[model samples]
Target: MSAAKPTIAVVDYGMGNLRSVTKALEHVADGRAHITLTAQPEVVRAADKVVFPGQGAMKDCMAGLLESGLKDAVLEAAANKPFFGVCVGAQLLLDHSEEGDTPALGLYAGQVKRFPDGLSDAAGARLKVPHMGWNEVWQTARHPLFAGVADGSRFYFVHSYYMAPADAALSLGYAEYPFAFSAVIGRDNVFATQFHPEKSAAAGLKLLENFIAWDGQR
Candidate 1:
């Protein structure tokens, strides 16, 4: 008998680029996974896994979640189901953000702040906001998210702010600007990536496949 397919809810918080994410997930899972793009809280709460994908300012994304009444549902989902966040969506899992002085979901104990001034040298060659385009993800620690994926894999990135989790042990991937910052994070069932895995090509697809196949017991 075939194994039961897991239902994944791609959260629609009015801030994410939903179509591309949905399309990429569909392709990787080969139609075996049920991907639902929804704003409904119950759908999120009921799903086997929840993906929080967004691209926008932190303030706007938080406000959208509250306005949609999905905040409570997300918290509940995180308590039980496997939760994944991408880009701005990943940053929201922290306690607060320096961006707009916004408070976050507080699922993880940490703060998100702007890249420090020292990140660049006197020449100012590396320090640029919204770090765009393809960059390499250096594996810092092994996690289920990195299963079937190797080190030095390049992923697409486009963001200014980055995450600094209090527990550095949760960090799975790091990227260099003038300094290194968290790229992929995995703590228990909560996983997030600062890069756009959906846009990262084959490596990205493999990461999604790993997430879908994740048993979530570890």
Candidate 2:
């Protein structure tokens, strides 16, 4: 008999484009796993793997997690299961965010800060805030989720703030807007990306594919 497929939870905290996240996972899973886009704590906690996805405002993200009562479940999964965080979902894992002065889940010790003013590129042109569009991510450390992905692969990004972990060892990848910033961060079973892997086309799909197969180590 074949083994049962894993149940992967795409945490729907009422902030992100859940359909896109879910579709991406479903595409990658290819029937090897069950993808659940849910706001229920029980569903999140019962899943074999968890994906925390976020967008919009930090205050709203936090509020949605509380309102949906999925915060504790997400924390539990991050601590013990294979968890992946994307965009604002990634930021919320930090200690705090300059966006709305919001306090985060504190699973990782760090702050999420906005891009400073007067930022200029190498040619000295002004760089835009939110850091929209595509940017190349320079992987800083080896992790199972990075399998089959090149070191400096470009990923889709749309955020004004970036995670700055207290421990530099937690940095998984770096990308530059004008200066290098944490593009990916992880430790243990938890992995996160400032970029939306769902929107990153081939490279991003590859990442999601890897996460589905990852054992949550390193």
Candidate 3:
């Protein structure tokens, strides 16, 4: 008899791009694991791994978590199992977000900060807000989830606020938008990315592939 496959939960709190995140996971999972898009806390807590994804305003995201009663589940999963956060999901893992003076899950000690105005690149050209499009993510340390992914590889990004962990040692990856910003943050079983790996191409797929195989170790 074969062993039962691991269960990977994609948390749905009515804010994230669920279909894209789910599809991406399914693509990489390829029957190695069972991927579920769920709002039920019981299902989430019972899963072997959890993927928390979000987008749009921080206020709405928090409100949705409360409305759906999945906030505690997320916290529990992050504390006890492998957790992967994407975009606003990554931001929510921190203590707070300036996006609406909103409080978050506090999974990590940090703040989500907005990009300052009057920004300019090296050529002195004005940079846009939201920082849309693809950007290279530079690895800060060797990690299991980062396995097989090259340093300085580009990933898709579309956000104004960036993650700023209180402990600089928690910073695992960085990307520049005129200046350096936190693109990935993690410790132990929790890992997060500000960019959308599902929307990114080959590099993104590789990252997802790595996550499926990761054992949540340092």
Candidate 4:
């Protein structure tokens, strides 16, 4: 009899697409763990690892969490378990968001902001606001999440808003889109990314594996 496998929960708050995320986790799990998609706070609280994946407006995201009554559970998990946040889920960890002027979970001291319009690159070329498609993520700090992941790995992104942490130390990855932006942020048990790992291919899976193996330590 060996140690029991870990149970990972992909939190579902009826905000974004949860199926793709759940399927992705299942793919990477490979029978090494149990993957669950849950909106119940109790179920989430009991999971060994938590993956909070979200997209869409911050107001709706926060509303979904609250409406589902999983906000406290998520907060508890963030402070306790090995936690992972993706996209809007990552943004919710901040203090506030400009999207509908939403007040987020505030797991970290920061704000989620909308990218400025009419922005241009060095060549006076126009850049989109949503910043969709695949973009390169440059690691800014050394952490287990980037264990097998290269310093500059491309990940799928789809969002109009981005985060800017008050404490720069919380920023672990950066991506340039005409201007530099924090693509990843982590500290202690919490690790988050603005991009979608499930959609990201090999590098993303590797990062998830590292997260699963992480013990929530420094």
Clash count for each candidate, listed in order shown: 0, 0, 0, 0
Count: clashes, candidate 2 = 0
- Candidate 1, residue 157: Cα displacement in angstroms equals 0.8
* lDDT tens digits, residue span 148-173, model 1: 88798999999878899998887878
What is the C-alpha lDDT profile of model 3 across 99-189, one tens digit per residue? 9999998978999999999999999999999899999999999898887789999999999999999999899999999899899999999
Model 3 residue 77 distance off true place after TM-score fit, in angstroms? 0.3
Candidate 3's displacement at residue 217, Å, is 0.9
Instruction: Please state the error at residue 68 of candidate 3 in Å.
Output: 0.5
lDDT of 2 by residue, 1-218 (tens): 11368899999878997899999999999999899988789999899999999999999899989988898999999999899999999999999999999999999899999899889999989998879999999999999999999999999999999899999999999999888999999999999999999999999999999988887877
After the best TM-score superposition of candidate 4, give how far the Cα of residue 44 lies from its true spot, in angstroms: 0.7
Give the CA lDDT, 0 to 100, for residue 120 in model 1.
71
Q: State the lDDT of candidate 4 residue by residue for 1-218, as single tens digits.
A: 11257889889999766998888778777877788999889999989999999978889899999999999999999999899999999999999999999999988999998999998889999989899899999988888788888888999999898899999999999998878889999899999999999889999888887766677776
Residue 9 displacement in candidate 4 (angstroms): 1.0
